[model samples]
Target: MPVVFFAEGSAAMGPEARAVVARAAERARAWPGVPVVVRGLAATDGSAGFGRALSEARARNVADALVAAGVSPDRIRVQPRGPVPYEAMQVESRRVEIAIGG
Candidate 1:
């Protein structure tokens, strides 16, 4: 499970996120013909609509980053998940998880 953490209300990828994306892309390149599924998740902040939009945007941002890192666009699938309540470490909820599969 490759995860990228994001700041509150932000879709931009920081240094750490970039590093993670780079690593994922490298792995993707290593395993030829495998499709990678990147799911973006965001914490609920009262509004479901807003949360969904944010999550989608975050997911797309990560997908774009991965593509820019040399991963084939066709090999990446972006799935944005709606806000999920987090009782502990809510900040950790603001993230995108990348899973590589065939």
Candidate 2:
């Protein structure tokens, strides 16, 4: 899994996130027949609805990046995992995990 962090309350991709997406896209392109799962996650902040929407947006952003990088859209699945556990750390909690073989 290749992980990329997001801002606390935003889905905008920064340079680091874009780099991660590029790496993941490369892996997906390597194994063209494999499925790519983009799991979007949020920190334990704000309301549940807020987290859900944020995660969804983040997942879509990553998925869009993958397709732009030449990964097939059909091979990508966006899984909005919503909020992380309340005890999860800030840096690690707000992220999306790109799983190339699930």
Candidate 3:
């Protein structure tokens, strides 16, 4: 899985995130027939509704970034897993995971 980390409370992509996306794009280009899944995740700090909305927006932002990185929008799918509290550090939860599959 290629993962992009976001800054605290923001959906803006940083250098690290862009690098991850670039790598994912490269992998997508290498295997053009594969489907890329971009999973957006959010921290569990806020209300459920707020977290869901934020996660969805963050997911879309990641998908947009992937498109900007030259991956066809049609080849990417966005899945927002809202407010998963698995990460001990809240900041670590703010991320988008890109996985290539059939």
Worst 10 residues of 3 by lDDT: 83-92
Q: Which stretches of candidate 2 lie over 4 Å from their true place?
A: 85-87
| Reference-based TM-score of each model | 0.91, 0.93, 0.88
Of 1 and 3, the candidate ahead on TM-score is 1
Worst 10 residues of 1 by lDDT: 82-91
What is residue 95's positional error in candidate 1, in angstroms?
A: 0.6
Q: Give the TM-score of candidate 1.
A: 0.91
> Residue by residue across 4-44, what tens digits does model 1's lDDT show?
99998888999999999999889988987999998988887
Local distance difference test, per candidate? 0.86, 0.90, 0.81
Candidate 2 per-residue lDDT over residues 1-102, each given as its tens digit: 899899888899999999999998998999999999999988766788888888889999999999999999999999999876646767777889999998
Candidate order (lDDT): 2, 1, 3
How would you order the candidates by TM-score, starting with the best? 2, 1, 3
Task: Give me the displacement of residue 86 in model 2, in angstroms.
Answer: 4.2
How far off is residue 24 in model 2, in Å?
0.9
